[model samples]
Target: MLTVAHSVPKTPEHEETIHKAQYNVARAYFMGFGAPSSEDDGRRWLDRAAADGTRRGSVKAQTMLAMLFARRDTLDLEKSFHWHSEATGNGSLESQGALGVMYLYGLGVRRDLVAARLCLTQAARRGNIYATGQLALFYYRFRFYQHAVRFGTHLARFEAADVAELARQSECLPGYVRRGLATGCYVLSRCQLLGQGGLAADGERGRLLGGRAAELDAATADRLQRLFVNGPWSCASYPDLGVEV
Candidate 1:
C-alpha cells in the first residue's frame, strides 16, 4: 500500500503544488514547529525562514544572533553593544537589559553613569528584574551620600520614605528579590550603624542586618564586610566605625 501510494505519478503541475505545500509546512516549523528543542536547530530554521523574508523569523533570528554574539566574551564589545542596541530598539526586553548593563559598566561606550541610569530606568520600567535591582542599588547609594553630607543628620521623612519605597520595589522584582533583600539589609544596616540621617545608633541591629545581607549572598556579604572594615569610615574622617557584632 505504501509503495503504491509512493508510486502514484505526479504531474509537473502536481509537483509544483507539492513543493509549495512543503514550503508552507517548513514555514510553520520555522515559526516554531515544536519550538525546536535545540538552539542549533532553532537557529537553523530561523535562518532559513529569515532568508525567505518571514518577518517573525527575521526578528527571532536577529534577537538570537545578537544574543549569541553578546555571549562571546572575546567578541568586540563595540560590536556586541551594537547588536544588542539594535535588538533592544526593536523591542526586545532582554536586549534592553543587556545593553543597559553594558552601558552601566562602560563596556563599549565612555563611562556615563547618567546614561547607564537612564537605560536601566527604561528596562526597569519595562519590568526587567535585574534593572530593578540596579535601580534599587543606585538609590540606596544615593541615600547614603545624602546621609553623609548631613554629618549623621536624621533623614528627612520624605527621604526615608523614598528609601523604603525603593527597597520595597527591589524586593518585588521577580528574578532579583534575594539580591534586593540583601541590598535593603545593607542599606538599613548602614543607616543604623552610622547614626546618620537622624537615625539612632543601633550597633546590635546593624550587625544583625549586615549578617543577614551576607547570608543571602556570600560574595556580596564579604564585599560589604570588607568595605565596612577598611573603608574611610574607620579613619579620622568618620570615627568609631567597626563591623563587629
Candidate 2:
C-alpha cells in the first residue's frame, strides 16, 4: 500500500492528487499502519502536504497539522495558527472551530472577540459540538440573550456526540475542567435556571448541572457562589429553587 501510494507522488498529476497521496503515506507512517511509526517523517510529509494543500487547502492534512501544533502535549501556537488559518479560510469546520477557540482565548493570535464570535457561530451552525458548547459560554458571558438562545442547549449534549467530540479531541471531561467548559456547563445551567433561552426555566436542571461542575473543581464552586449568591440571580425571586448559593 505504501509503495502504491508513494508512487503516485512521482507520477505526473495535479498537486492536490500528489498531496493527497503524500498525506496518506504520512498518516500511515505516523500511525504505524504500513510503515514504521515515525513522527519526524509524518511531520515532514504533513508539511509538504500542507504546503501543496494551498490550491484547495486540504482539510485533512492541514487539520491534522494544526492539531499536531495545538494539542496540549505539543502546543506550537504559531504553526497551529498558520495551518488552522489556511484551512479555516478554505472552510473546514474543524479548523474554523479550532481557530475560533484560539481567537476566543488569544491562544495563538491576539484575542479578537469579533473574529472569534464569527468563526464560532459558523462552526456551531456546521454542527461542531465543541463550537456549540463554546458559543453557549461565549454568548452567556457577553449577555447575548438572543445569541444564547441559539446555542445554549449544547450543555445537554453531554450524553451525545458532544461527549464523543470531547473524547476525540481529548478536551471534554478532564480537559474541559481545565479549559472552563465545565464552567460553561454551569452557565448554561444558569440559563436553564432563568429560562434565558427557549428552555422552560428549570432550577432542578440548573442544580444538576451546577452540582456536576462544583463536583469537578473547587474554582467553579467559588464562581458558583459569586454568581448564584452575590450576583443578580436571586433565589428569592423564586423560592422553589432548592439549592442555595
Candidate 3:
C-alpha cells in the first residue's frame, strides 16, 4: 500500500523560496495588498516564515511580529519584546533600535540605560538616523555633554533649505525620523547656547538650529524646553515626548 503525503516535504534548498512566499502571503493578508485583510491568517503565515530553519526571514518576520504586537489595539509588550529580542539576536538593525527604545522606556523589560545606550549606539553607527537622534538625547539626558554633542552635531548638519524641503515631504517620511531630527537639532542648539560641549559658543547657530527643530517637530521642541533641566536617571526623569506627522 502506497501512502501519499499531503504536501511536499520542506528542505534546506527550498527554505528561502518558502520563506519569501510565506512573507508575501503574510503581507497580502495583513495589508490587503492582494488578499482581504486578516491579521490572524497573516500571523500564521508570518510564524511559518519566522520558523524557517535557514533564518533568512528571521529578522523580517520577527520584526514585523514585534511591531504588530506593539500596536495599541493589540498591545502585547511582552510578545513584542520577545520578538524584538529574537530579531536582535539574529542581527536586525531595526530590532536593535527597537530594543534600545524598549530598554530606554522599560516597555516590556526592566529599564536599563547602559543597555539602551549600547543598542542605540550600535544601530546609530549603522546609519539608523532615529537611533542617532535617540542616542544623542540619551547622552544629553544623562549629562554626557561631549557624547551628546557629537551625535547632535551629526544630525544638525542639515541646512535651512534642507529642513524646509524635509518639512515639505514630511508626509512621506516616518514620524520617528522627523522626531529624531528634531531632537538632534534641539539638543545641538542647547549645547551651542550653553557651551556645555567642547564646541565654541554660537548663539546664532543655536537659534537657527532651534528654529529648524521647531519647523520639523514643534511639539517636541516645546516640550524639551520645559523639560531641559536634567536630574538623576529615573523613569520620572525622562518624559516620552512623542511627536507625530
Candidate 4:
C-alpha cells in the first residue's frame, strides 16, 4: 500500500501537503517514525509511495537508512552495504564514493583490492574528482608505482585534477607514499632540467616543480627540498634525512 503521498501540483494546499510529506519522511528516517527499534517499521515508511515511486524520495530514504546502519556499532554490515550499494546504483555519486570507501576498507565485505579499484574507477570515470584522488592514493600506497605515475600523468594532461585531490588523499595514505610521489615529480623535473631519466634534467625546471610542491604542502615540500639538498641517494639512505618540522 502506498502510504506516503505523492508530490502535488503547485497550490497552497499542495504545498502544505508536500511540506508535511517531507517532514514525515525526515522524521521517519531520523527519529525512526515511532519505530526506532524495528527495521521493518522503518522500511514500511521508506517503502511508502513517496519513496517507492520517486527518485528523490528513494535517494533520501536510501541515504538515511545507510547512515542509520552505519552509525550502529553493532549494525548489520550486509544491510548497510546493501543500502549504500542500492543508493549508488540509483545514481547517487556520494553513495557511489561511499561504497568505494566501504570496499576499500572492507567494512561490510571482505577486503578486496580489485573490487575497490573497480568502484573507485567507476566513480572517477564519472568525473568524481575525489574518487580519482582516492584511486591515486590507493595505487601509491599499494606500491603500484606505475599506476601512480599514470594517474599523475593523467592529472597533468587533463588539468582537471586539483591540488586538493593530492591533499585529500594524503590524509589517508602513508607519509612515505606522499613523499615518494613528490620525490618522483622532483626527479622527473630534474630529468627535464638536466636531460636525465631519458631526458635532460633541468635545474631550473626542477626548482619550479619543487617550489610548486612546497607551496602546495609546505611541510612535505620543505622535507623534499632538504632531501634534494642532501643528495638523493644519500637522503634515501639517511635514517631521518634530517627532515625536521
Best by TM-score: 3
Q: For each candidate, what is the lDDT?
A: 0.49, 0.64, 0.73, 0.52
lDDT tens digits by residue: candidate 1, 35-105:
44355554454344333322223333444445455454434556566656665665656556556666655
TM-score of 3: 0.77
- Cα-based TM-score, every candidate: 0.49, 0.68, 0.77, 0.46
lDDT of 2 by residue, 67-119 (tens): 78766577678778888888877666667777777777666678888998898
The candidate that achieves the highest lDDT relative to the unseen native structure: 3
User: What is the C-alpha lDDT profile of model 3 across 17-81, one tens digit per residue?
Assistant: 66667777788888988778999988888887777323666457877878777777887878888
Superposing every Cα of model 1 onto the true structure, what RMSD results?
A: 12.9
Off by over 4 Å in 3: 1-10, 52-54, 158-173, 218-226, 229-245
Model 2 bad stretches (over 4 Å): 8-14, 154-158, 161-186, 194-201, 209-245
Q: What tens digits encode model 4's per-residue C-alpha lDDT throughout 134-237?
A: 56546655556456555544543322134346445432223333443444454344345555424445678667765554444456556545654674433132
The ten-residue window of minimal lDDT in model 1 covers 236-245
Task: Give me the runs in candidate 4 sitting further than 4 Å from their true place.
Answer: 1-57, 72-76, 152-245
Candidate rank order under TM-score: 3, 2, 1, 4
Assess candidate 4 and give its TM-score to the true structure.
Answer: 0.46
